[model samples]
Target: MQRWPVLLFLAWVCFLFFAGIGLFMSGFLLTRIELASSSSCSDPLVPPPWERQSLPPGSCWAPQRFAKAVLVIIDALSFEFAHFNPAKTSPLPYENKLSFLHRLATSQPRHARLYRFRADPPTATMQRIKGLTTGSLPTFIDVGSNFATYAIQEDNLAVRQAGRVVFMGDDTWEGLFPKKFFRSYFFPSFNVKDLHTVDDGILQHLYPTGKHGEWDVLIAHFLGVDHCGHKHGPDHPEMAKKLTQMNEMLRSLVDHLGNDTLLLVAGDHGMTETGDHGGDSEKEVNLCCCVLSKFLIPPLPLQEPEAVPQVNLVPTVALLLGVPIPYSNIGEVMAELFSGDGDAVSAALQQLSVYHINAKQVRPTVGLPIELEKRRNVFLSTDLFCLVQVGWGHDVIFVGSLH
Candidate 1:
């Protein structure tokens, strides 16, 4: 054989051998990490196993009871922003000020509850939305390049259970849920020049026939805040103006809908000083949860409040809509929020306990296997982070900082 040909053959062999080894290592690490991450909490706060609590046998739509639920999620609205005002009395130096947001924060029917959890690790729009819609965190470690595919594959279980789910926002909003499962009302986030136009579109859809009885669940996400935050930092004048605008938009919805609707206002994640997110940075991922409605939203109370964890949103919403929760759901319904006697509350709690813990194995301690699994694969790659921007506008580049 010629010398050059022999050398080329040797190089090819070496490349194949190394590539094979690398792939095998990656797969092994992933499996090991997944296993380690599966440890059940020893003495886990398992809700009591399931007991049947039937709603009074009657029509689904009653005058006193809500026939529908509307969840309005404001992407990137931080709890810090919701509670703190740097320019409390002073006017912000921006043309499109967030006066509406400030007014809503101060004047709207509001509930503030301490959400107990570190900010979501996959600190991006789509991943957090997935967390809100489905009770599950992103499955992959790194933010995947093909996030839309992953999100649909994972599916938003909560949205699927609703009678009718109308999602109105940027195309990214459409990517978060499976297309086949839900009827989506999509709009180009980039096309609309005005935020109120988007809001109007949502209002029109909700009242297509000038009636609110159509959709069982209406989720409207306003992307301007997050959009502005990415271009300018969250604390920037431009961002503040947009926040105020969004706040006003929300207020408009509340004014139109009145007290009968439960309005949930939340930010998927916050931005950092650099106007970037995708790590577990405390500031980057912290969320703002503001519930404006006659009903008690999580962390808030109709009466004496109890400390429920942040994960409770999934089951709580599910129970209220009278939907059957999946076996994988881990959160419990906050029974204490309903206005009723002690016996009624106890029954609700008991019913919630049964729903949360049935068919799930209880692990008292964080098992070594589970911990190892999380440390290795779950935390190693950036698939989960990639999922955050699955249907987002920006190009996702892994800077190798899943530290």
Candidate 2:
């Protein structure tokens, strides 16, 4: 070979080596980023909006009236993802179907509610999870170690009130709740060599025959889809394969549970190409709620049919449980879903709004008084309340009261 060709070939090989290295490093960092901000279950220092108040048991109104148990699964879910893709993603063909997911999305007695939020700069699993569990976004951007903290700690008065709560997932599941509270069953993430075995352990515990009414609240996190998405992007065949597996697993469990148990299937956060989150990507997060029982409330009209966001989820689940909507939750309960009675739900929602506004008015304990004034305009602009103008767009001031 000529000296020049040899040199060129050598250079090309060196370039390819570094390029491969770069890609691997990027994937590693992306995986770590997703796990760090999105998957951890502990609450951050500032806490999210929903985590602001711990409702004393039975403080609001509704408590375990509609359904006996609650099941929450956060999909590769972004608030923006749900807003963008209201219709279901195209399903795989017969041999490749996600039977459980497909059934949940399309079946009767299974109502799906899409919630839209007014918050800006939406992104990340932890933030969305905080919003779902608490009713508001996290006060600070980087708070919350995982979803369990929001479920057990924070202001999860509903979970506390439940007769029993069971959480199943990877190692992160262990961190979401305090050991003293709900009985937690954990499985390591799919990245572990024996991921399926861990899942089996969980399924066995949850579906042990002859064991009835074991748990009042059950939250299971399936990591296969999320893991595959992170490792191979959302559109990849591997991702779809994992989703199919998850669907099958869920369907089997649901069949085992039968009518007495209500199955809720949802995603924690969605993923985009480039394998990264924390930005307002349309695919960053999307969640779907599928109720397995015939007793669920029917669907309700979407306020702004065009702008479906994710924060609406908290209110929907609260309504399903017949729990009084908290004062801070902005979304309305699907009136159609209530068993021919919406008065109590409506009244409870009003009270929740009152509580939210009242809570905001209280002086801040952590920040300086001057800082509060500086941020007043920003706070007022939030979806929590609006400043109205009389006559012309002048003499603007906050208006509206629940009482």
Candidate 3:
């Protein structure tokens, strides 16, 4: 063959090799979501305090924090959907359609507040819920568990509070909690093409069930917001309509709520601009965690919403209701929710500090003050020890999930 012909053949081979590599990289980027690893259940450093069936004293862990709790999860509800309703003075180009949640969070006496609850990557729904309910970090394994047939064996308060806990919405909970609900209207969460099925079923049943007034806990998870995201991207017209519908339903529920009831609304994970998730970008991981009630949570947090770990809710919920923190929990107690009798708040903080120290069995838990708890339950503090023990990449990893 002529020299020119040979040279062209060689160039073609090189192009194929590089193209093959590029395709492989793209596939890996699109499908794999793992960002961190976790300690095995048998990891020796894990103390008994962080295991199943163990109890750590919580300052607000008392008997019956409220008469009831209602958790309404509007899947894929991003921070912008619920937290911001730019006033006329604001400069964003689009005409701002106000959400009912905005009204509730900023009402004269403030019937509710919205927080920027952070979510970890893999932003898959199941992994997010596992993190939310168990107060546990998402392991790289959760990527598999998101589709695996395995049952979640971790301690979950929603399951523990089973007898009177009513559930309606995504069937994902059916798989995760498996027979833990008292009365349930489990609707299919798949089928993004037919968006209304799950939401309609949930809406039809939710109000009637609430009217019955026979449960201590009511959990209603809406799938429409997420289905819209998957089908039409974040900027779809249906997105706003779905959010508006959710706000109306929730507002109605709050209007009828008795003095002792608390309503919590949150997104399991946020969607990317293209309406897909499983990444660590802000739009994909920042969602809203809102609380509503007839009475004010004293010493309300900042007037504007603040960001906090999604895991923090586990301990916060446990403390609010006087339930024990899950044995394997790593969540911090959220302090801004409750107004203070300084001493009581102090005691709760101390409880969390002690629990943190004992759970990891490593020196002081990272980010906690050394003087906060004097308990010498486990390992000594060291820079490397803290990072390795947390499994969570940094001091801050989690916020709210769409669940």
Candidate 2 residue lDDT tens string, 1-403 = 5999999999999999998877654432221001121111121223234445543453333334355555646446333322322254774221234444544444543343433333222455555555555444342322234643443244442353344676766555454444733667677663632325455555567565313646656776655555555666655666556555665666566655644455555555555665456565555543444445535444443442443344445555554454543333333343334434356566455445434432332222443456333332222221223333311112343353111
Q: What are the Cα lDDT values of the candidates?
A: 0.50, 0.46, 0.64
Q: Locate the minimum summed-lDDT window of 10 residues in model 1.
A: 386-395
Winning candidate number (TM-score): 3
- Ranking of all predicted structures according to TM-score, beginning with the best and ending with the worst: 3, 1, 2
Please report the TM-score between candidate 3 and the true structure: 0.70
The TM-scores, one per candidate, come to 0.63, 0.57, 0.70
Flag regions of model 3 displaced more than 4 Å.
1-63, 88-98, 108-110, 140-148, 161-163, 301-306, 341-403
Instruction: Judge candidate 3 against the unseen true structure and give its global Cα lDDT, from 0 to 1.
Output: 0.64
Cα lDDT tens digits for candidate 3, 218-333: 88889988888888886767777777677788867776667888788888898887788877799988888887777666546335435677777776676566555565556666
Number of clashing residue pairs in every model?
32, 35, 18
Q: lDDT tens string, model 1, 279-320?
A: 768776666565455544333243633223334565556555
Name the runs in model 2 displaced over 4 angstroms. 1-60, 63-65, 77-96, 103-122, 139-153, 190-201, 209-213, 258-260, 299-308, 324-332, 339-403
Please give the distance, in angstroms, between residue 238's alpha carbon in candidate 1 and its true position after superposition: 2.0
- Candidate 2: RMSD to truth: 12.1
Please say which candidate is ahead in lDDT: 2 or 3: 3
Best by lDDT: 3
